[model samples]
Target: MKDIRIGIIGFGTVGSGLAKTLYEQKDRLRQKTGANLTLARVADISITSLPKEYSDVVLSNDANDIFNDPEIDIVVELIGGMEPARTFMLTAIAKGKHVVTANKALLSIHGKEIFDAAVKNNVEVGYEASVGGGIPIIKALKEGLVANRINYIKGIMNGTANYILSQMTDRGLPFAEVLKKAQELGFAEADPTYDVEGIDTAHKLAILMTIAYGLDVRLDDINVEGISSIEPIDIEYARKFGYRIKLLAISRNHGDNIEARVHPTMVPENHMLASINGAFNGILINGDTVGDVLLYGAGAGMMPTGSAVAADVVDISRNILAGAINRVPALSYLPEHIGKPRITPMTDLVCPFYFRVTALDKPGVLSIITGIFGKHGISIRSMIQPGQDAGEPVHIVFRTHRAAEAAVKNAIKEIDALEICSAPTVKIRILNPE
Candidate 1:
């Protein structure tokens, strides 16, 4: 119940922003919570990198300084990686110090071990910043919406991917062109594989799955498909069909099993998520009682992510003052309740699909392809030959009724192998969660 001393690791953009929040609002926070919060020490590879305004705070090149400090009640980790961030968090837990982290990749991969250690050591772990930056989606899932049974979670969780896709959709630009533009504007990293390939979204989805379903879900459990494969023409055809394309991270709870996937989805333009464009995040959560709710905001940034970390700090600090250890379980479920669920394989997933097949535009070419779909038990709901189906190279667009994933892929394989096929089929999942 005394003053809760805080130590911060990784003095980068997010780290400095936390220091600012604590420094600027120190008095206001203490007055409201009736708990003294101190920004005691900060550690990084180069302490000098921290600005002069933070010179009064203790600076250390070695994180062990904070890990070993007995008075520090909480450790805020802002380092965004799999290495020292994971080790630092573990050490903090081992030392019986509460932890707050924004390292989604590390948590998604090694969270079980870190959380197990926290439970054994009797310390709290706050990871509100891991998924939605400043959106507070983590808290909402774990606490705010605790009473409602979650039906599904679909989100545009990655800003860089969303921005790229939005640019491609709005300007009729190619993926590469939009990607380069995103990088130039500092919205994306130079190496944007994780962002473009849906790896980052998968990581976040894994964490959300764990929280929502009480499952020990791993990143690999989710089926991942990136937006880099999306072509401008595909976007054009999607718009023609009254839809817009966005990279969506999705999960659905099916009583006994769960569906987890991250891919470029054809969302109806009328849906709330389709309107979420640019460097923004929109998470559409459907609960049995709540019906529908959308959490939208800046998905990632120095200030936005830092705000999330600070929120965790406040949450953990309140727990410390209450002397109620583990007042809320880290992943929203009690330790004994946490277990893995059967992940519905991608092949077993049933959804409407969009396919753009390029063929030789010869007679009977259409029948061969339709025959393959029939063989796979997929029925076409709509078809468009675009300009002419009788050209040297044909671009045929088709939308199908709800069909199995295995059936669609099998049909695509057969269609692509034919001599009349001009290019590999462009396949995208359609979002029709009605």
Candidate 2:
């Protein structure tokens, strides 16, 4: 049997992790898969020095080298963006090479095109690393659990933001201070916008929903809310009421429509997801037969993610040797058989809420606030008035029953206009996930 040659693009972090893993575990991997996987080339933006082990393999910044090399059987893309990554993956497929990528953004934006190209080229594209780092959730959905109808998927996708929020709630640090510490620790990126602002989670959700519901949802269509405005005070109150604040990405099938939303949510403190702290990811999936199944692990890291990519490469090797007959479908179903699931608008999502209201401390202030909720057809399930903050103002907590987000938004607009309420309400949805 001949060795399977692999060319890795963007040899940093996960890229180098894959190279080192394949090099070190060559004999073991071959024994497990009956395939000899070899890292024949490496590409990246800047080069310092090769890791001595990959001395014979071609080392160049030019990605075209991988395509031109006849020995390179597979192109593994770990580059994280859309431009050159997407273009390069398509080109590799056109050259009749198999591709395995960890670029969720590229797939979320240009998946249809890339998958079409792979089908046309009669090659396979593996994206197991794109959804969950080491958690094989993509394979679970696309293979093992294919028979069940997935009713809902709720995930704690971003780890950096989760770490910050966990610290703020547990250690009582302010949001800004904790975020600064996260940046220094490298758990968070220098910019941190995508991670903290919910865009990164939304990108992963966009990919997950496509596989779960077979929906071609636009990124803009998913309701996204960041944890930027989250306050320690709100976290404290949520804890007092037996809930933990978590940035959750959720998608559910609501009859004919599927609802997808990413936001700071209040999960019951007793729930398993609430206990998932620091830089880790957990996904709770519900199906008709499987009921509730939970998947949790290190969401992002060099070797954990690299392990996933290596598994894909091995699977591709097997598929190629098997004549590509029994491989799992790319999107978990045949292309034409995938029905277009309708995405429910954000306003249509109905859920309970946790809102903090800062108001002028005075008599009948509660009445004025309750009046707005009444006017907008909203009802309050519980209330918390901690007291006045020195000479500043009064802070009150209101936990409401499930209500249409549109109604809640309308009531917020009215409350913000009132002289009793100082600003727009600080809102967070409550998820029981039954």
Candidate 3:
């Protein structure tokens, strides 16, 4: 019946947002949850000085202050990395403090260890804000859609990369130019490798895959391909063929093995996810009985992400007050009920392909390319010559039918080795979700 004392670690963007939201909506939260949420301690490296509201509440440069506090009920970790964050969360769990975090990278990589620690300590760990920002996709997977077997999940997870690629397609701007604009808008980090290189999306997908399918998939196991290699010309050609380029994170349970990959995919223009533009994130989940489900919302930001974190705080408060057992398992499924599946390798994945090749603008070149594809048993669904620049290289686009990824790679190697070809090939998976 007393207030739940909260401590926030790493008061950066999301942490500060949580603190401000707690103060701004205190009255409403108290009325709804029947328990007051109060921030008793805050930790961050950037603070030359702490906020005035927390003058009485302990403030520290070291995050251990939260773990050591006897009154703190929940320790929220917003620090976005493997180090210190992992150690801090573990320390909190060891101290019998409920752990909540928005750190996807840390969770994706070391989730098993963290979850085991929580279970050992008989505490709860909430990570609703980890995957889809404010979308609450994690809760949906854990609670709302708990009955259905998840067949597949596809999502646009990285806002910066999505924004850049979407802008490039719409405005016909070069990738570099669009990325520069995104950087200026504070949508991208100084080192955008994590976002642009598919690592960020891969991390989120790993967490989703584990929860949805109850599989333990490491980050290295996921086949990751970023959108940095996408040329503006590819986008134009894709549009000509009624497709849009998007960096998608896809996970599927394909009976034999699990397919988890993050890459720049050629999604059909009419598909619902294709219309998801700008910085918004959308997830399409295929359930056995529920059919297709779509969840879209603000993927990132101060208030949006903070709202998710706050919701978890309220849920924890209610459960603790009612003496209800933690109904939701840490990884969606109960620990003993977790399924073990092998991560299908890239070469084993079967999907349609969209490839671009630079070849000499001359007769018989197209025939030779098609000949090699046939030899490798790769059937071409369609082909296009997107015009030749004045004295520049000729661009050819090919839409190939579904085939083993190994065969596609072999075909591309054979085509690249042809005397008529000018450069390495560009291949993007074509996802035709009807």
Candidate 4:
């Protein structure tokens, strides 16, 4: 069997996981792919964290050592971020070395440049582990669903945020408390802003949108809203309405325009996405020919994510054995075929909404709120006004029919400015997938 020399940069969680997979599954990979994979070198600042078995593998403090080595055929970059990883990958491509990475942020931001370099150098780039870990969603989109036109994609992409939200929903805990528990369980980073604020989900959505629609979408284009402001009362109200709240990354193609957003969404309790809890992930995709397909699995973890990276390695290995490069276009479409689709502004997008207003228990409060909704051309489908003690700020909740986001925002702003309203209105978009 032909031997494939591999080099890894970044010996962090994912990097160590990849090493473990390479060490334990080497024989199985050889049997499956007929390629003897060799872990030639690993580049990390501290080699102390790596297991002792990897001592035989070449270790270096600088990543340049791996890039400079001519024997290394595949460079797996697990060191996430926008800096040296981008430069290192470009250098590897320039040197005609294939790349496999799980860095979603780098790819979402600098994919076009990196893919261009790979094409220019006639090398393959595999990133199956970038999005849904161990779910094979990348391969499903690029290969399995190649024949169909993808209509839309919705997913619970961030495990950290999902875990927090799931805990809050299950235990009736608040966001802060659940977030602390998530951090204690290692589900969240010390600084969980990226995951909790929807940036990470947006990064993954950008990658998925590019592959699904062949659009040059960027993370900045996605409308992002986090679950930081989601209250236990809001969750309770959603449960009362037979729905569950999930942080969802959603994208829909409308031919001339596409909608991409990440936010806390209320989905029907029976929906497949609603059933997904804990740190697991589920993606629901719609296509012209396939109708709707759901892919569910462990979204992130050592073994699951490492298996995904190894799968990408095997894919590149097969391509190498066949003497083919750029076997599939990096974004699932030829560069020339990629068209710029206008991203529909969040203000113009139409969706049902859930509104919570805390207003002084005085006369005409409901009338004023309803009048503002009417002024904005918003139609309320249903409302709840639970009994409140005298002279207390009463909670009023309304579910609106399909309305433009701009109208809803304007109405909320006007209502919040009213004398009777105690706090800014809470708004959560309601998602009822067809």
Candidate 5:
């Protein structure tokens, strides 16, 4: 069998997991692929906690050792950042080595540059572990769903946000409380801005949209909204109206345009995505011929992410053994064939909305609110106003039919200026049926 030497750059949670997988499953992988995959070297700043089984493998503090090594056929990058990871991967490709990475942020921002380098060097870049963890959604889009024209993709791409929302819904806890608990449970980072604020989901969404739509979509094009604004009252109102609230990353192909956004969405109760609770991730993809398909699994962790990285290694190894370089384009479309579609602005988005307003329980308050909606051409589908004492502010929730986002924003501004209103009105967009 032809030997395919592998070098790993980081020995953190995922890198350690990859090393362990390669050490334990070497015989099985060789038997299945007829390739002798070897874990030749690992480079980390510190290797004190390196697993006992990998002690025999070469270790170095400088990543350039792996990048410059002549025997290494593939370089797996588990370092999660933009600076050194990007530089290392570029150097690896420049050295004519296949690259496998789990760095979503790096890929989302610098993918085009890195892919161009790989093409110039006549090498393949595998990033299946960059998005969806262990879901295999990338491979599915590249190979399995290649025959169909994808129409849309919606996913709960951030597990930390999902876990926080799941706890808030199940326990009726507020966002802060649930986030604190999530941090204690190691599901959320100490600095939770990326996960809670929807930036992490935007990174993953950019990758998926690029592959599915054959476009060069960037993170800047995605309209992002966080789950920090979601409240217990909104969750209660959503449940009362046969819907569940989830942080959804949505993208749709609109002929000459594309719609890509990440925000808190109200999904119908019976939908499969609504049932995907806790720290799990679910993706619903709509293709012209395949109709709809759902991919669900653990979106993060050591082994789950490691499995994806290992799969990428095996795939690249197969290509090496067959002497086929650049078998599949990085984005599943030929570089010249990829089109640049205009991104639809949030102001022009047309969708139903759920609104919660705190206002004084006066006779003319409802009339004024309804009049404002009518002025904006936003028709109400349904509303709930629980009986309250005449002098105190009460919660009034309304569900509106499809309307332009600009119109809704105008109405909200006008409504908030009213003297009878107590707090800023909250709005959550509702997802249309698949």
Candidate 6:
């Protein structure tokens, strides 16, 4: 058995996990793959202290040690950023070593450049941990579903956002309260803009779309919306209508075009994804041959993500032993076959919408709102208006029939401008079970 030396940078959550797994399970991995996979070194700039178990392996405060070394055949970049991570991966690839990573944001933004460089250097990049933690969705899509054309993909990829939403729905708690609780519980970061604002989910979604279809999808191409605007009232209303609000990352194939967006979506109660709660993740994928497949697991944690990174190491090591470099292209497709996807504009999309409008109690207020919706080609399928005292502000919630995105925006703008309105309307897209 040939020895494949490994070097890891970033001793944070994921980096430490990878080191521990590779170190402790060295015998098991060698027996399984017949390759001596070695944890050659680990480098991190933020090591105040080190775990006693990891004391046997090497430790460095700088990343240059990994790049400068010649014996490291696989460079694992777990730093989770753009600048040095990108540069470090490129440097390792330039040295003709296989690269593995879990940095979704960096890969989503600079994937084209990195993959281009990998191709030029004749190396492979493993990113299975980038999307659904340890779910193995990337391998399933890349190899298992390679024969069929993908129809659509829906996933709850972010555990922090899911935890916040799950708390809000189950306990009827406000968004602010749950976010604070999540922060205390270590499920969320001090600065959670990435998780809460749908940016994190969008980054993962872009990577999935890129693999599912041989297209290079980016973060800016996705239409992202956050869970901050979701309120208790909206949650209650969705329950009454036999639905639940979830931050869903969705990508659909529309023949010549594709639909990619991330937002707080209204899912029917019976949908499989609606039942996925807490810091867990679930992905629903449909291929022409397989129909629908659901993958559910702990999206993020020490062992789960580390296990993913280790799996990539084994795969790359086996390939190295077999002399099969680039056996599977980094994005599961060659550069000649991968190109920019035709993303469908959000404005032209047609879907059901839930509107929460606040207006003064008056006879003509309903008429004015309905008139605007009608003029813009939007038809209301149902509405709920609880009794309100005369002249007081009343909340009228409407579930519209399938309407164009442009029509809904125009109608909401006109209705909010009305003199009798109390507050701006809140709109959320609804996805009925298909």
Kindly list the per-residue Cα lDDT of model 3 for residues 1-434, writing each as its tens digit: 58899999888889888988899898998898888889998888878666787576667888877788899999999988998889999999999999999989998888989998998988899999998889989988888888988999999998888999999999999988888889999999888999999999999999988888887767877888898888889999899889999999998888778988999998998899999999999999999989999999989999889999988888888887777636678787888877666888888877888889898888778888888888988899999986775445798889988878999989888888887778899998899544
Error of 3 at 297 (Å): 0.8
Q: Against the true structure, what is each candidate's TM-score?
A: 0.97, 0.97, 0.97, 0.98, 0.98, 0.98
Per-residue alpha-carbon lDDT of candidate 4 for residues 229-335, written as tens digits (9 for 90 to 100): 99999999999888899999999888989999999999989888999999998999999999999999999998899999999888999889988777788889999
**lDDT by candidate, in order shown:** 0.90, 0.87, 0.88, 0.91, 0.92, 0.91
Every candidate's CA RMSD: 1.4, 1.5, 1.6, 1.1, 1.0, 1.2
For residue 122, give model 1's deviation from the true position in Å: 1.1
- Over 100-165, each residue of candidate 1 has an lDDT whose tens digit, in order, gives 998889988899999999999999998888898889999999899898888899999999999999
Give, for candidate 6, the lowest lDDT window spanning 10 residues. Answer: 48-57
Residue 297 error, candidate 6, Å: 0.8
Q: How many clashing pairs in candidate 5?
A: 0
Candidate 1 residue pairs that clash:
none
> Quick one: ranking by lDDT, best first?
5, 6, 4, 1, 3, 2
Better lDDT candidate (4, 5): 5
lDDT of 6 by residue, 3-118 (tens): 89999888888988888888789899989889888877888887755677766567888777888888889999998889889999999999888899999999999999999998
Model 1: how far residue 408 lies from native, Å: 0.9
lDDT at 347, model 1: 90
**Clashing pairs in model 2?**
none
Top candidate by lDDT: 5
